[model samples]
Target: MRSAVTGTAVILAVGALVTAAMTTATASASPPAGPAKADPPRPVLVDCTWHKNVRPADFILACGDGNSRLIGLHWSQWGPHGATATGVNMVNDCDPYCAAGRFHAYPVTVRLDGPKPWKKDPSVEHYTRMSLTYTGARPDAFKAVMIYPLWD
Candidate 1:
């Protein structure tokens, strides 16, 4: 009977010690409660170079031949949904030939929308569509406003 009591007491003591140790460890291991670190800012646009940027001053529309481009971009808004800018659309006439074409600049209002994860870097977002409204004389045969699907 005495041995049984001693064994029970030993077991209870060991259990208490283990419980206290576990409580202390859990308390210490818990993360400190404070303001969480902010996530990195997502980009609104990806230029022809596949580089992410926000409110870029210039962007190329023609990645292959550099025939069309936007310059002097002044962004009015750059939010998660979309971005708006007023710039000049510079395009080559390609009158005689592409190599000898003359470049013309026209006033334009640009809108970037449909942001999606960039394939090259999933952590970053890039605009999937670009809409341009010509505020002045536009390129020949081109409409007053045009929408183009941006590269992923």
Candidate 2:
């Protein structure tokens, strides 16, 4: 009777150990209660070609008539809030008329700011304001520094 009692006790102890082991394994394998966090998406620039770009070599300021644009862009800083670049602003002289105008290049420092969700796609962000500070020569009717609103 004593041996029988000892055997039953050992069985119960082993069962308890097995149950504890399973509980621990199940807990470790299970996923977290809440949804997993995802990293923030990287911002992009929507160019005149209607494509997303990062540090584009050229960007068009005048999408309608293509009278103004930026070329040879060398971006020094591009972040979530803003971007800074050094480039040349090429504008049409429009001497006789726009169709027969000569394009001129001016050294410029470009700053892109006012980050907002793009109109076409809310998930994507784009710069809404662009500032141009002419370092050397400038356009005929323009100032040394100018700011323009970018299109979505």
Candidate 3:
């Protein structure tokens, strides 16, 4: 009688352990509820160049590079009243191909020309120049987003 009781207890214990293990595994294996969302794309860097020149009655800021595959331009006119002008252009180079096998480099240049009174000398015009250099790796899985101040 004692042997029978021990055998039954062992069987019950084994069954319970097996059931618990199966339940835990099934819960874990099931997929999560929500749909998977992909991450946003990243930006890539190409060749670029810029310059600023002060001319009478206006300021000329120019930037460009033959090596860059993609090029963009922007400008703003600062005077008594705030006025702005902007433009973008994409150019593809033939050499030093992009990672995606595209023969294009991103290039950007800007030129701002306008009349503004110098802060120090009200009689003289002030010509201010500014430029930007972007450096980063291109994303493999996502498309790049190129943004410029003039885009807005």
- Candidate lDDT scores, in order, read 0.91, 0.90, 0.38
TM-score, one value per model: 0.73, 0.72, 0.22
Worst 10 residues of 3 by lDDT: 41-50
Q: Over 4 Å off in model 2, which ranges?
A: 1-39
Q: RMSD, model 2, all Cα superposed?
A: 6.2
Ranking by lDDT: 1, 2, 3
**For model 1, what is the error of residue 40's alpha carbon versus the real structure, in angstroms, after optimal superposition?**
7.7
What are the per-residue Cα lDDT tens digits for candidate 3 across 1-152?
A: 99999999999999999999999999999987787786532111111222222221222121342323222334354343232333332333323563333432333333332335544445544333223233333323323434332100
Error of 2 at 83 (Å): 0.5
**Model 2, 1-152: lDDT tens per residue?**
99999999999999999999999999989986888787656567787878987788999989989999999999998888899999999999888999999999999999988989998999898888889999998987789889998778
Worst 10 residues of 2 by lDDT: 36-45
lDDT comparing candidate 1 with the true structure? 0.91
Ten contiguous residues with the weakest lDDT in model 1? 39-48
Estimate the Cα RMSD of every predicted model relative to the unseen true structure.
Answer: 9.6, 6.2, 20.2
What is candidate 2's CA lDDT for residue 109?
A: 99
Off by over 4 Å in 3: 34-152
